[model samples]
Target: MMLLPDAEQLLANLTERMRSGVATDTAIVGIHTGGAWLAERLHHDLKLPLPLGTLDISFYRDDFDKIGLHAQVRPSDISFEVEGSHIILVDDVLYTGRTIRAALNELFDYGRPSSIRLAALIDRGGRELPIAPQYVGATLALPSDKMLALEKSSTGKLSLRLYDKNPMGHEQ
Candidate 1:
């Protein structure tokens, strides 16, 4: 099912939940692409203590050869201190958990934070690894043959849409 939320509502929900558990000095970090989109919104809404950090996990993926390099490779920016600081890792969607895994690897390369909490806009179940989002905008139980995609306009607007899979029972 397509259980998407309005961008404003999703932003409010995420900010509220993240503020509840996040330490006073917590930092916000977003995974590349979709995650970064959500993070930008949350950062503006929440007024986080530290500047936002954007990470590109494409180069850090274990299956890099299979997926190949993404067209865009944004640098992971966390110029501020990381050790002993609480971090909120943001992503657009949570599915197989491989992206989160790859994100963790990239995060460590910078510095080890005291703790890292996950935040996702949507959680579609199909976890290849044991990972969960600490804060979620919505949860959807989509059919295996369907796919969920998050898109953002150049103006920084965000939305989610569903696409039917091809004859091969995979997202086209």
Candidate 2:
């Protein structure tokens, strides 16, 4: 059995690093689902002045034609101006980089930002595209058949879970 790192501690470390490095004008935007949850904590802990943004990225996914729409699709929301502002794109895991690509496609639709930095809770080693996280809480390696996921409790505690990848190429 693979021993996972503590999600809460990892998050605390990530927030501290971001607190010192992020630009004053930087905006935090989380990808839907897990990313959104992490972003919420980061935004509050970092004390960012700008409103938090969340991206669904469902429609922007490159494999949209193959997978079609997801069951729970939330609309992307960016209340602040995107042009000329620095953006910290948050995600739970950085794996294939395809999700980041889709997020970039959706973000540009709002307007070009001055800069965009990726922040991931975990950085798994597989990379199908050239993408890297500027800030990472942890780096873990696991078998191709296993998947890592972040879970949040009703009281807002965070934890990590390992699941066997479904044979159909979907997460359980």
The lDDT leader among the candidates is: 2
Clashes counted in candidate 1 amount to 0
Scanning candidate 1 in windows of ten residues, the lowest lDDT window is: 163-172
Angstrom error of the Cα, residue 38, model 1: value is: 1.1
lDDT of 1 at 76: 76
State candidate 2's TM-score: 0.96
Model 2 superposed RMSD (Cα): 1.4
lDDT (tens digit, per residue) of candidate 2 on 39-115: 99999989888999999988887776766787788988999999988999999988889999999989999999989
| Clash pairs, model 1 backbone | none
TM-score of each: 0.87, 0.96
* lDDT of every predicted structure (CA atoms): 0.78, 0.89
Model 1 lDDT tens row, 1-172: 4556675577677788877786558788888778888887788777776888888887877666655666667877776688777888998878889889988888888877889999998888888898988899878787877777788877777777778755533111
